[model samples]
Target chain A: MNEEENRPVRWNLDDNGVAELIMCDRERNNLFTDSFIDAFLGALSEIEKERPICLLISGLPDVFSGGADKETLLDLCDGKIVVKDLEISERLVAAPFPIVSAMQGHAVGGGLVIGLCSDVMVLARESRYGAVFMNLGFTPGMGTTELLPMAFGPFIASEMMLGGRMFRGSELAERGVPVNAIVPKADVYRRARRIALQIADKPVDSVYLLKYTLSSEKRKRLIDARRNEDLMHRITFPMPETRRRISEQYNE
Target chain B: MTKEEVIEVIKRNIVENLDDVEADSIDATKSMKEYGANSLDMIEVVSTSMRELNIKIPRSELAELGNIDELADKFMEYINKG
Candidate 1:
């Protein structure tokens, strides 16, 4: 087995109040296991406590996150973990500071959910990403329904979600995905950090106010979308076809 | 577009976007924020007004105009400059 990074999600706060959350659980492909979820929440608590002016979420050299762990889904079915699912995306989206998602490799499913929650996104020109819940044999668990359409508009969002398409960053740039920049793989972090610094340098009060203003529509819509998705997820997770797909995908 | 035409466009945009504010009560000197125009409403005002008038209002320049009169004046300046 390949060794995972000691810290899957590492949080760093600079003196200027720019915080970076690095995801590096390579062994598990950065899947959302119990450990990852605990670390994720703990890191977010620290970020809230530290009151960073802006946030940057990036991943290891070539891989961002693989998405929700199928193992975790089983636990969810067994009632070991209660899934308040959408709140995860909401927390990042509603964070007081501006967020910049710097994507390297591919961010899919829950990973894509997190990226879309941020205010601005920058993808490595060579990397790929997708909202592939359909491939996982379930309706979208995260608030991707609203986030996808919000980021890419109705027509593109429809094709991506319904078709479960994996999109190259350059292709998305060409298709007019509203990403802030499509930089080289090596430059993803640097570019995102620069943008985070620019946001942090602004008046903190107004920065937060503007985030609240801009995100209000999406935030509200996500709350409603999650309520319906919750029912859909519960219903679909137990279906025979869903079980077959999950088993095949994970080779269970 | 004449200054009168520009003013008409701005006023029409405000009335169309903001439901709470009636067109008759849209005082030119008052801030649009006072008329219950939130950030999204203001964005709509800027976009629709610019599109209708066929003028480029840089996003940064939007912060400088506080009231309907000021916005109308800026639009007139842009039209005259063109």
Candidate 2:
């Protein structure tokens, strides 16, 4: 393992050169608000120095995330969060290491897209995944529309997105989405760490290139979609019906 | 399609999407949004309606429509204006 770089992303560099990257913001459901995005980038920059062989991304046990914070979405509507999120997402996708997301609960909208950016995912058997931007009358900004169709195939991905269906690990794994193992929530990290350690033992260069290849197209398209999402959001935000609908939902 | 037909399509969508909502209760006059049809349910209804009827209602409009009455009114308004 390379020397630990100090950053807010809270990296724990084990003796084996395995970096466990736990997201620290409990507020905002750990959704990367603009500030968190900057802090996370700084942290990821620090982690890059050690060139850790593998990464384990874990979060709060119950809600992996509820998606982008309402405030962040508001910021996105105003063009504040989109650029920063795109930068961070690009860096995350380009990292020269295998990322394994340890998911234990519901991951919706942007949160699920970030999880998709990881190379391998280990999920709790009961965890739910969704493309839930539709709930807020918006499309996802993190490039989920393209990523899901590529990962899970068009039919199921369309159902998940257009239908706004939230699927469990069992259902997703059966559909060929690349989750490595489904374990009990209590053991999710344990299994993730075990997988990470195994990867860490491999030749670093081989693993890095393997991950880079898998992540390349998704990363490029994510940045492009970020811009597309920005344009679409701007067009949608000011419509009279959009405001009326939001007001109604808030009252409800 | 008349307003009733549009409402029927939306109702069929809600019934198909909700495992718990019984099919018999989806009266066109009742608001789907009012009877505990959360946002996910609304998405399904909107998507299904678009596919089945070849009519597109912005998901944003689903929020504004409130109940079945408001949605039907909007659909009728869109049709009549055309």
Chain A TM-scores, one per candidate?
0.93, 0.84
Over the true interface residues, superposed, what is the Cα RMSD of model 1? 20.5
lDDT of 2 by residue, B1-82 (tens): 7777877777777765554567667766666655555454465566666667656555556666657767777776666755
User: Candidate 2 — which residues are off by over 4 angstroms?
Assistant: A1-9, A78-81, A174-176, A243-252, B1-82
Ignoring the other chain, what TM-score does chain B have in each prediction?
0.89, 0.70
Native-referenced DockQ of model 1: 0.01
- Best candidate (score: TM-score): 1
Docking class of 2: incorrect
Q: What is the DockQ of each candidate?
A: 0.01, 0.06
Worst 10-residue lDDT window for candidate 1 chain A reads A77-86
Model 1 steric clash pairs:
none
Every model's TM-score: 0.71, 0.68
Backbone clash pairs in model 1 (N, Cα, C under 3 Å; residues 3+ apart or in different chains), count: 0
Per-residue CA lDDT of model 1 for A1-252, tens digit only, reads 334348777889998889988887777867887788778877888998887889899886766776788877665555454563455787887788888988976787888888888898889765667777886678887888888898878888888788776666766877888778987788888888899999999887888889889989878978887888888877877777776666666652
Off by over 4 Å in 1: A1-5, A76-81, B1-82
For B14-82, candidate 1 gives per-residue lDDT tens digits of 776654457778788898888866543575677678878788756666777878888888888887888
Indicate which candidate wins on lDDT: 1
